[model samples]
Target: MKLVVLGAAESGVGAAILAQKEGYEVFVSDMGSIKPRYKAMLDAHHIAWEEGHHTEANILSADEVVKSPGIPETAPMVAKLIAQGTPILSEIEFAGRYTDARMICITGSNGKTTTTSLIYHIMRKAGIDAGLAGNIGHSLALQVAEAPHSTYVIELSSFQLDNMYKFRANVAVLLNITPDHLDRYDFKMQNYVDAKMRILQNQTADDTFVYWKEDEHVPNELPKYSDPSAKCGFTDEAQPGSAGYAANGTFVVNAPVHFEMPLSQLSLPGRHNLRNSLAAAIACLAAGVSPEVVRQGLSDFPGVEHRLEKAGTVNGIHFVNDSKATNVDACYCALESMTTPVVLILGGKDKGNDYAEIMPFVKQKCRALVYMGADNSKLHANFDATGLPTADTHSMRECMEHAVALAQPGDTVLLSPCCASFDLFKNMEDRGEQFKAWVKQYGEAK
Candidate 1:
């Protein structure tokens, strides 16, 4: 069958490779430049690909299309495909059809990366043959094509879940659903919620669906998408019918296997992490990992980068890089975990964000605020009333200067910009790296 792949990045390139391996005629098209590394992969496979433009004639003739999660349905090419009644599948969906691996999928607006990594770490420690894929690791399609594992621990985003129809997760984890990516969903909360609920699609009684029991949205949507028999829930406090819970300063997992560990033993800190730990432990246990292994994994698993990562200390001031906090809810978690007074950095491409969600934390925990973005008007309008010391900066250098000036010796300068970094940087990782670099340079000069 003729298979066309759109957006020649990780997911798109990986999908093209897998489709070629499956003996389908594969073509990759990107409206933007393909990275040199990806170009080489396509060349090595002798696959036909075009960069910087898409040929409609070539794309229109395809029997099926694998679209990058980054591309929205609003894109002209995608809309054309829809208009033509062509099947467009995500890389995750296409890869799922080729692999018999037991899928352990994790999704949420926050903590999904940490939970996905933690689950992978635990599965590896327990000597289970597993591959890390989806949002955090190598593309699932690439892994399925190159090195298929007996099991796969995937960190899924709502974008990846949107096009997935027949993919089934043997163990599914929904961390939490909050107001995020509303722009892609026409600024509708239920539309975003419905996309997240897609992770539970194709799940059966034999499949396990693990989720945050306390999420404001998940409980209301659970009955609409999944069976009660497949439900496994984790929460901060023990409740009736909970699969995992925390009590008396210990994390507990009941189903799949009885397990408990002191909350203090968890490597990742904060109340949010306690819930993350609960979810990971439950997922690992449900996958048949031993209780002892899960405990050790939880205690030793390293935290995710750019999510509450410490950049460095400069002149007795600490800097944290939480660039992954592109939404208000994530920034709320970062602020909630801060013990030191924070000179909070906030601003970027606004995603129709409601700063009110984090207003309480900002008023309580922040000593000062730094607005860094192409536009800081929204931030100012929301926070200027707080009357805390504030600075407006369009660049990272200026942001660092203002942040350092506002911070005292013991204060923490956190780069948890509660918005997308595209206004000033390539992506969140670039924003975080630049923040760390500035912190390192400042420390050296001091």
Candidate 2:
């Protein structure tokens, strides 16, 4: 079988390696320059690959194509491939056909990484054989290549769901939906929402859809995609169903036997993360995790890095790295989680952000604002009436120094850029690491 892989990043490379191992004739093509590390991998394995071009003739001849989630289905080459009647599938869907692992999948506009990581953490804590993959750690395909596990906690994105068909999660989690990645959906809210709903497309009655019952967007339109047999819900503010709710400070799920744990006992803080916590707990329960394991896991899980991770204290002022907050809605989540007044550092490549959405939170928690990115005008324009001290800094170091100079004891300096990090750093991880390093230096100076 001739199989072609697109976008030679983590997912694409892993898919190519897996296909080669399975005796399928594999070729990898990337429209952009492939990373040196991935290029090395392809070379070491003698895998045929091309970069900076998508040889049209070669790609369209394949029996199937495994697409990296980052590539849209609307690319001209992709359209041409479709026009030629060639099949394109996500790396996840392609990989799933070969694995028998019970899948635990997490999705939402936010909190997916935290919840997915937590479930993987708990599964390992409980001595369950679980592998972490998808939008988080290593590629799921690579993990499958190394050692297939009894369970997999996958952090899924709307992009990954776009090409997936016939892939079913043993447990599916929907955290909360808000306007995110709208550019990909042609700037339409419903189109993006519809993309998120795709996670439930193949779920069955025997399967489970664990979600936040109180998320404003999910509940109102969920019935459109409802599957009565798979319905399971969780809410921090109310009991949404017969099970998986916060009643008496615990998330309790009734199905597949009862499970419960105190809400205060969860290690991850904030109303938003609590929602993530609730969804992860329910997924664990549906997968047959005992109440004792759930309870222990919830209280012990430390939380994922780059989503409100602690960077250490300089004097009495704390620095937090939330560089993963790439949109206004995610910024709202980060701000909502803060206990102290924040000298908030935010900015980057704007994705047509509606700063009005976060105005209320900004008016309340932000003591001062430091912007880091290529474009700060839109942020400044939206914040005109908020009356918080604001400054535009072009890099992470300047943003940190300016933010620290404005902060005093008890004030938190948060690096929760509500925009993509490409303007100032290579990506969110690079942005986050720079923030952490500066904070360490800032701490030592005091």
Candidate 3:
């Protein structure tokens, strides 16, 4: 079999290596320059590859193509492949073919990383030899090739789900559906929603489907056919039949196993995290993890980086890096968690953000707004009317400097952009690292 992999980065290179290991003739192509590590990996494997351009002859000859999620359908080469009816697969789908690992796949506009990490922690604590993959940790294909495990907790984005066909999750977790990446979905909310729903594909009676009961879109879009898999819902309120919820300062689970714990015992912050905790607990329980183990794991899980991570405290002021909050809903989650007055660092590549959703939090919690992005006009226009103090800058350094100036004792300087990081940084991780670096220096100076 001939396999051509697109975008020679993490997922693409992983796919190539797996294909080679599976005895397929493999090739990797990236329109952009391949990272040195990935380039070396391809060379070490003796796989044929091209960088800076897609060789049509080499790519078109493939029996199957595995594409990185970042490569959209609109790319002319991909369109040609589609037109020719050549099979196109996501790395997730391709990887699933070779793994007997039971999959716990989590997908949503928000809270996916937290939920994925929490579930992985619980499984590990319960003595399950589970691997983490998909949008986090190592690529699933790479893990299947080398260090395979009995189970996997994967973080699936809508883009990754779009190309996944027959892959089934033993436990599917849908946190919530919100308007995000609408541009990639052709500006249609339903398109984005449909992409998220693909997580439930191929689920069976023995499988379990976990979702947010309160999300406006989730309940409406669920299949109308007589239910097969155990359908469980998580919410802030523990309804009569909910799989998980919070009630009376307790985290409660009623499905797979009955479990309860003091809500105050959860290590993560905010009401959103409470929902995340509920989802993770229910998924872990459905996977046969004991309630006691689940409770312990939830209590001990440290938290994911760049998602409301604590940088440091200087003379009482706190610095938080929530660089992963790349959309309005995510930003709302960060702001909602803030107890102290916030000097908010906001702005990035705006993804058609509706600032109105966060206006209430801004009014109540935000003392000053520091904007950082190539374009801040939209941010300025939307937020200026609210009468909040705002500053505009083009770099993280300036953003942090403004934050330090605006913040007082007992205040928080938060880096929750509510927008994509492409404008001024390579990605969210880079943005977060710069924030942490500058914040460390800023704190030491005080």
RMSD for all candidates, in order, please: 1.1, 1.9, 1.3
Q: Which rank order by lDDT, best down to worst?
A: 1, 3, 2
TM-scores of the candidates in the order shown: 0.98, 0.94, 0.97
> Could you give candidate 1's per-residue lDDT for residues 1-446 as a string of tens digits?
99999999888999999999999999999998999999999999999999889999999999999999889999999999999999999999999999999999999999999899999999999999999999988989999999889999999999999999999999999999988888899999999999998988888787888888889999988767536436788777889988888899888888878988888899999989988888898888888898999999999998999999999997889999999999989999999999999999999998889999889999899999999999999998999999999999999999999999999989999988889898889988899999988988888887
Task: Report the lDDT of model 3 for residue 320.
Answer: 92
| Range of the 10 consecutive residues with the lowest summed lDDT in candidate 1 | 222-231
lDDT, candidates in the order shown = 0.92, 0.84, 0.91
- lDDT for predicted candidate 2 compared with the true structure: 0.84
Q: What ranges in model 1 sit over 4 Å off?
A: 226-229
- lDDT (10s digit) by residue, model 3, range 305-385: 999999999878899999999899999999988889999988998876788999999999999999999999999988888
**Clash list (residue pairs), candidate 1:** none
Candidate 1, position 271, lDDT: 89
